[model samples]
Target: MIQPTKDEIRGWLSEARNELRSERFRRRLLEHELCSAKRALGNAVLKGQINVPIEKLGELVLKLQKESETEEADM
Candidate 1:
């Protein structure tokens, strides 16, 4: 039988923990990712790679957050 290395075992455990995550915890993570994503998008727009107005960005975030909350309610 093949044995997994210590690093591989640790990675598996980390993935398993994520799979068992609570909705509240997931929502918190979503919020963190949302912030980072917005920052990245802003940088991309500044670099001229994407074109998005400030008002549009705000609206998009609001729509995404509302959808996320609805999904969490079902979870």
Candidate 2:
């Protein structure tokens, strides 16, 4: 599996959110993306890559939590 940079992940998530027509669908997609991003981030962390800043991890977690909250609100 190829490790993706935080920027790449952010771009992909942004594109997904933009392309989605409904908020409910976007939230669902975001949750899926969070899982994929976590796996990619795990690989990067294991490789000890100094290029990808550690700050991105927290940002990713926060983004996922926010998405979750949004999803819950829709229910």
Count of clashes, each model = 0, 0
Cα error, residue 20 of model 2, in Å, equals 15
Name the TM-score of candidate 1: 0.40
Look at candidate 1 and give me any clashing residue pairs: none
Candidate 1's displacement at residue 71, Å, is 16
Off by over 4 Å in 2: 1-34
Alpha-carbon lDDT, every model: 0.87, 0.80
lDDT of 1 at 29: 97
Please tell me which predicted candidate would have the highest TM-score against the true structure. 1
Model 2, span 1-75: residue lDDT tens: 989999999999998887765776877798799779888877878788635566987786788889879978988
Per-residue lDDT tens digits of candidate 1, residues 1-75?
Answer: 999999999999998887778766987898899889979987998898998888997898799889979978988
lDDT of 1 at 51: 88
